[model samples]
Target: MKISAGMIVWSFCLAMAAGFTRSKPDIGVPVALAYFKTNAEVFASATGELQQSIDKLDDDPASVIKARLALKNTRLQYKKIAFFLEYFFKSAALIYNSAPKYEIEEPYMEYREPTGFQVIESLLYEAHPATKKLELLQQADVVTSSAKDLNALLYGFTANDKQLLESIQLELVRVITLSITGFDAPLLKTGIAESEMSLRALQTVLQPFREKATKTGVEVANYLSGGIAWLHQHPDFDSFDRLHFLTNYALPLQRSLQVFIKELQLQLNTTHVLNYEAGDLFNPAFLNLIAFLGADSSAQWQIGLGRRLFFDPGLSGNNKISCATCHQPEKHFTDGLTTSNAFDGHSHVPRNAPSLFYSAFQYRQFWDGKAESLQSQVKTVLFNVQEMNADSLALVKHLQQDTTYSKLMGAASPIDQIARCIAAYVRSLNPRSSRFDDYIQGKGPALSEDEIKGFNLFMGQAQCGTCHFAPLFNGLTPPLYDRTEFEVPGITRTDDLLHPVADTDMGRYPLFPMDYYKQAFKTPTVRNTAATAPYMHNGAFKTLEAVIEFYNQGGAAGLKLPIPNQTLSPLPLHLTPNEAASIVSFIHTLDDAEPTGLFIKKSNQ
Candidate 1:
């Protein structure tokens, strides 16, 4: 009795199912695992066969079309196998790793039932028998050369909704045609191949019940158009930092895609929403949103608000001081005094108000790095008895009554929203196009000989950029918001006319409670460092030269300021005074021409 191909396929499927069931240790393991393992083997075999056919075609022109068809099939089979493997791995991983106990309240995973290992094992075994038949079909699809036969094979893959496989088939055809035609083909075979690939891939990925072709085509077209537009807008694509762009765009795109996939999953009652939109995936608008969200105009508003909040004496107990009394923008956002003069008139704050420029990049705020975020620091300054003696709730209420603040806080959450907005504005205060920016951007003439020498010293011998970093020249990590390392350089204990505080502030230790953070402070941006006077956590240094010299000698002698975990180096800088001065000159080059609207006076009531 001869076995028909259809009967053989059915029998092989049964065997695969049996294999799946036996392999699973429990009933809960997916049967898809069996299918994936079998498909991987089939794909591997097809790839091997296709390579042989390609070698034969290179030696024989008559067989080119036949070889190309075989290659297409091989590619398609491999892609289908690869796609399923990816799906299986991702799904299996999710099942194996349950949500953390603390994250039980998370909205997305809250409803998922506890999956048992036994149940998983049973499902795994049930899917095993079908694997053999699928593998055979995949192999057959790869070696076929007849256009009708190839189309039929392709249709089957699409019917299974394996879009990535279809796309791979299209890509293989395009490449094979290009190789044969030498870029001068009259028919532009590659274009036809691409169109077919797109159509098939889109069809496979879209919902089985929907008008797959039309809807998928529209989505693909839109994605392509958006990509083209983005490319046009950013013509110097090679110059733009790829990692930086990707890092900036990744979060927003991930969030958007997750939301989209969730919506589709709900509509289809299937877990594989990404598979449907696989061929038409990108986030053009999210990328565009980056620029507007971090622009100078926004920064201006933030800086102005910071200034207003800084100077508003009403926040203080005596209504005689504000943040600006210490951190004056005119003094590069620092009071000229060594230590900040607080609201109690004669009481001096423990540390100086560092310059606000490029501070948005720092991990922690304040000279002691007591606040983990800018918002926290703002709150501290507003509520501290020694500074602004205002209650946060009362401050919010007071601001709500003011027409100016009321208008600014319109429809926004009074406290958190306002704090975030102010932070947003501050983060946008990136003063690019400086001499250093010009130098980095290839405008070589922007920096003078001394300044250029200074830049080299800072990055090399001086090792400033190691802490300050590039572009923003602050504590910002290369492409993300990882906190900068804090350092403690011992300052001399002083007895003053006002509030005499501890000689050593213990910087970030009190807030972080980490041993390493003791006496550590966030590294301030070097941009506009020249203008901000009286440096150091205690505001002990009076000049850039003084600060540079202090670092040159490696903090205070025998001060036991532990080797900062994130220090640029353990070795002393050992810079000559002349080199130090050169670095100072380079630091001076960071000052930006003051922008308008940053210093607008409040309307006289």
Candidate 2:
């Protein structure tokens, strides 16, 4: 009755095979399986070999080179396996579980159908495999027993041949850790509806092909049916209300599939497929059905909306400044200024403009946690006199006149529609193709020694991950989508001209009225920290070293700012000047190239 990991995996595989029984399996599945099997076996063998090498090192320490090589190989193998596993889990779940079925078919129900396996597969192939590879690399560790072993490990890690492992490891861990909630019960539950919806959407897309694309489509449908059957049979199935279930699991799965399809297209160089017009994937009659099921929310729409709003000057006051002005796309969606210039231009905004890349996973919105939702944050920026300076009514009125806005907003109330569209877009801004991403995916040789050292320090002595957390690398408070908690870091008024204020800025408490939230700010993403300068509230520091030194000394030394309960612990990083520079270099590697012309395009009247 007790299922081992192997048994669990086997069962899942069988279920998958059974799901596709009516037709041939999609090529992606087999390719993924082959890759998974090969990597798993290689890793297992590599681990054994590494253990033997370690044993040999006991007798002859000079054999550290051999042990280091074995370790590196084992690490590389593990990276390959882990990346594929994540891909498989995401892809399979999309193909088999991302849909919704009403208990009773209602005449009034309007549903949006999901995207199909072909679409998902296409997207998956398009994704830069490097993104996943970099994530895996980030999670890897280089073991050393003594000075001799340390030297050997460093030598091997820095070797030209081993560059792949180093780079892949750095990027892999960064992406993977931020991609999913690791074994967190509540977070998992929260993700369920989205996942299920994604699966269901994929099913809808595949439904038409079931009779035509016999092999791939039928196979996908079968797996989906099995997953649905399993869900119905589960004892805890009825615990959640329908809405909760759909939002948490079903939708997320659909989203994942959409994302996967984009990845596939990227990998296969099938950009044409992605550019296919709406209603082309399914029959004309089914188009309405798809819309009713909410299945037409393609990755393009999601990602484009985020990018659009991100660059819209209308979102801010004066029609001159926009999110992009502060969070420059070329600089990895960070302004590269220490602190951002507010919309008014005369006053400086407290805190540096955090990178918008991979911000969806963050728990809170601002440094002081002023806004509760991403939507709220957007709204705040629109209305804040010093920031955007736009009245919500005026902004809504302006958007209501736009034809494209009409399409994106659909039938919802204007404000709600706009917010959701923008949020949908923001959520799609996850970064994937950094040097670190490549390393995580398996092509290795992406990062340098200094970068690797910084990564280790971040996870180890620096304790940066404790606050930044995984995957998204932002403050992710529990209870999915409950808005993030804020912290007051007691930033000082340094000699920096940007934030020359002598007093502290009261952060969240002013907005929320909670005693504990006084001066509390949201944790920003570190995905492109190197490009976002003037760190912290008031943007006092100009460089990464200055920020590191501030953290090492712990809080503005002589500042009269009140220390909040959640302030970071003093970390005398004890990093030498070179080590500090290495950490900075590593942070710079987090940048992803700016999104191209589409993001930069002005709105068509």
Candidate 3:
């Protein structure tokens, strides 16, 4: 039964008057087992239904529809245990929730085609697999068998109070970041229903942790209950004010849960993608540290050494080029050119420099999503002949020659340390408090009415939020900033949006050769869009308005580019000129009033 808002408040107050306590009930291993068992049962049932439907499909068109519809029920059942499964049984969870695309298998996993609820959904609904319907049923059988295997594997599943608390909070963040945002059920629009089911699961796991109805328990109970109730009330997909949802309900829910856990002195047992013990999703420290995952150190002194190397021309062969030659800080780290200058200076470099601010927020670096880490990105630029034209050995020798460099940079493998340090310096460049951030944080006057309306549109009909997600407004999806996302937003090589030709650059295809990744590039942060110009991989769009219009017209696909599987949904946004301007206004809010760095001139660097 759903707890009443008034009853929760009353309970909280009465319990508060009575005071709080930290003692726990016996940890519920059985609850975890039951959770796993229920998922196995549900997946098996769904698989059976699908098999039966597939059998009837030879004669009845309705059977295909029935099979398609049946998957939703199965999905909801899995959703109830989605976080629980993904938290522990991540490899097993992939059989249900993997993306409907080809993927290179991870080291431990076998190479296989995409097979999941989404793949099944697409086959039945979108792909219209006429001759392959039987093959689809075979996949269903495999999924069912895997679920049974997973059930057996989970026999030893256990959780202490700390893991339980961590899971719930992490799951709560997932609800706001992924669930309510429609990230999970992108095809079926079952995200809201799934979230409700997840909430029910949350209520179940958390029921045992009432701390004997003390104030701490009441607070946790009230917030979780209230969040669930709010979701129940706002069931519709289209009209849900997600911005309001995040600020009013979700933020409060996160805070209260933290307080509940802290008050109970729940010791953290493990760290997640945020890599911190607490894994506090909304904390600034968590936000800042996303980029600097593995290094010998991220000391300010190292960062200072990096800054020095950044401007020092000795890193280049002719003692003329430095990183700052192209990545000028005042210009948001871009050189304000269509493309950057080559080492020879007569010709332009291949691609425009992406802004350094918030660049490290995601694991994948570079416009093409080539480099896996920031240090590797530095290495790419250093040796790329077209860029800095410096060698690791030569740079280290140069570093040894400078007394100041030796003093600042540790007397070790100087070039490698310098590269890591430079990456650290780049990591230090963070987003300044923008108007949009301020408005979301409750300083309402930070954004004008038009900008506010624009934000709503961005999160709503414009489909910006669907791709460029919140907080960092990049592809590192919320709760865990681990996997970076890539998109093929069919764009032309030239600035002429009307006479479109597919941008010849095969973006992520070089790394992961697949049809979907053919023209797909990394989703870069749109934070300083107002400042950084000549957008796209080829630097085609010179103005933010032009970029907005490109998206408004559904990218190059809308411009009649023959892109079959262009990842950007090729549907015209139908934004009015005023509406487009409003979106631009909202984008402007992402710009720092001044770039947050020690500004240096390109000539000096």
lDDT leader: 3
List model 2 lDDT by residue over 1-605, tens digit each.
Answer: 88799998888789888863354334333333444454456555665665565455432435545644554454334434433333323332222222211111111223323322212222222224223322222212111111112112223221121222222222222222221221111112222232233234334333433445444344445555544443444323113222222223333333333333333332221121121222111111211211211123445665566567667777554668776677665666667776778776777876677766656544346666545456777667767777778766767766777666666545556665556566666655664556654553334464666677666555334445545654345665321212343555556667442343433666766765655455556777677677667677667677778777666555542233345343443324456677667667767766654554523534541
**How many steric overlaps does candidate 3 have?**
0
Give model 2's TM-score versus the native structure: 0.48
- TM-score, one value per model: 0.48, 0.48, 0.83
In order, the Cα lDDT scores of the candidates are 0.46, 0.46, 0.72
How much does each candidate deviate from the true structure in C-alpha RMSD?
19.5, 19.9, 8.9
Candidate 3 matches the true fold with a TM-score of 0.83
lDDT of 3 by residue, 126-168 (tens): 4355567776777687677776666676666556677767777
Worst 10 residues of 3 by lDDT: 103-112
Q: Which candidate is the best by TM-score?
A: 3
Backbone clashes per model, in order? 27, 113, 0
